[model samples]
Target: MTTYDFSNQTAIVTGGAQGIGGAITALLASQGARVAIWDMDAALAQETAERVGGGALAVQVDISDWDSVQAAIAKTVEVCGGVEILVNSAGIAGLNAPLADYPVDEFRKIVDINLNGTFLVNKAVVPVMTAKGYGRIVNIASVAGKEGNPNASAYSASKAAVIGLTKSLGKELAGQDISVNCVTPAAARTRIFDQMQQEHIDYMLSKIPRGRFLELDESAAMIAWLVSSENSFTTGATFDLSGGRATY
Candidate 1:
């Protein structure tokens, strides 16, 4: 029953070709916002963009690379006339293994894509928002960032860094009418689940008091509101979507 009028805004969702990102893209577009999807998957990204209607465009970009992210942002700005909202949803799953058995390279790769990519996108896009003095940003983090899932040390650490970045940047832009926030969602029924082991899956489910996987659309609903004008009072906070798993 939540209704929002975003007919005047332009929103960019990174990694918005599939899964939770695809859900977020469709939701925002339905609300009448000009949506641009940034993803590495060209065909799927283009397909989502088409489904979102006219004024929606898809650009292929690797978020982990700063130059690619910047280029995509520039393209989005050009297409949309200006960037008003951003949802950082692009990320790779980490190697689900113990620290001792974990390859250092794999760990670093997760950090680079999940953490550094989030940072670069924000840096590249914030300038436009700062110039306009109006913006809303939602960085998609995970519950692992908060409670630190045992085997997913890399993912947990990367998401934890996202939380830190959200708070820091939210504070920096709080006075400028731009709100920066992040969400800590529990195990979503997405491709990321396939990246985890059976034991890790069982371990995660046991921790969730609600005992159900989060729906992609449910998470999309939050991201849409945060990107909408209706979410106008909160900033620098970690909103929970943990199925009652998160105690703090």
Candidate 2:
């Protein structure tokens, strides 16, 4: 495992309670960064933070709501001192169904959490980063966003929006020291799989040329670098983690 120095840095990781986010939080903490876990699951967040144990704090947050996000950010800053790094990993994979047959409410919910949520969290954090003139942000997108997945229109669309948001924001902050970027990862077996149907899961697996699901630690390592000061010149770029699933 490559070690990156994060001494004196503070980071906020949404969805840090589990899955890829949990892995990220742990790595960041081990690298000497004070981490704040922003997640909806209070107990899980606290547990993960404790497990990380290097001044890791857990704050309940619903990234989809403006008020909720605002409160969470304030709380995180209050606890961790300031925000220098952010990893937007909190999101949901909506039900799989044909476009015409997709549930309207479900589609809206998916967008609300996956797309709008990223915007809200980014909006809340940019000013703080701007004031300091230094920061690193990594938004978690999906390969489905780049290459639309069958029967997963809502999820795909929401992730596509995330990619767009990351690009736009990265460019906006390019002149500054703050670097904002996103990653398009192929399917990884996480708790998120519980929300998806078996057919949908199998369909995603079939697309991965690697013939295996991505591990949480692999994604975490990539993200850890992206958020590190070492990744200075690459902003507004979408790093690929799709195992040959994305062409272009």
RMSD of each: 1.0, 0.7
Could you tell me every candidate's TM-score relative to the true structure? Answer: 0.97, 0.99
* Model 2 CA deviation exceeding 4 Å by range: none
Candidate 1: where is the Cα deviation over 4 Å? none
Q: For model 2, how does the per-residue alpha-carbon lDDT over 1-248 read when each residue is reduced to its tens digit? A: 88999989999999999999999999999999999999999999999988999989999989999999999988877887789999999999988889999999999999999999999999999998999999999999999999999999999999999999999998899999999999999989899999999988998999999999999999999999999999999999999999988996
Write candidate 1's Cα lDDT for 95-212 as tens digits: 7898889999999999999999999999999999999989999999999899999978899999999999999999999897899999999887777777888889899889999988
Local lDDT at 133 for model 1? 89
Distance from true location, Cα of 30 in model 1, Å:
0.4
The CA lDDT of each predicted structure is 0.89, 0.93
TM-score of 1: 0.97
lDDT (Cα, 0-100) at 96 in candidate 1 = 88
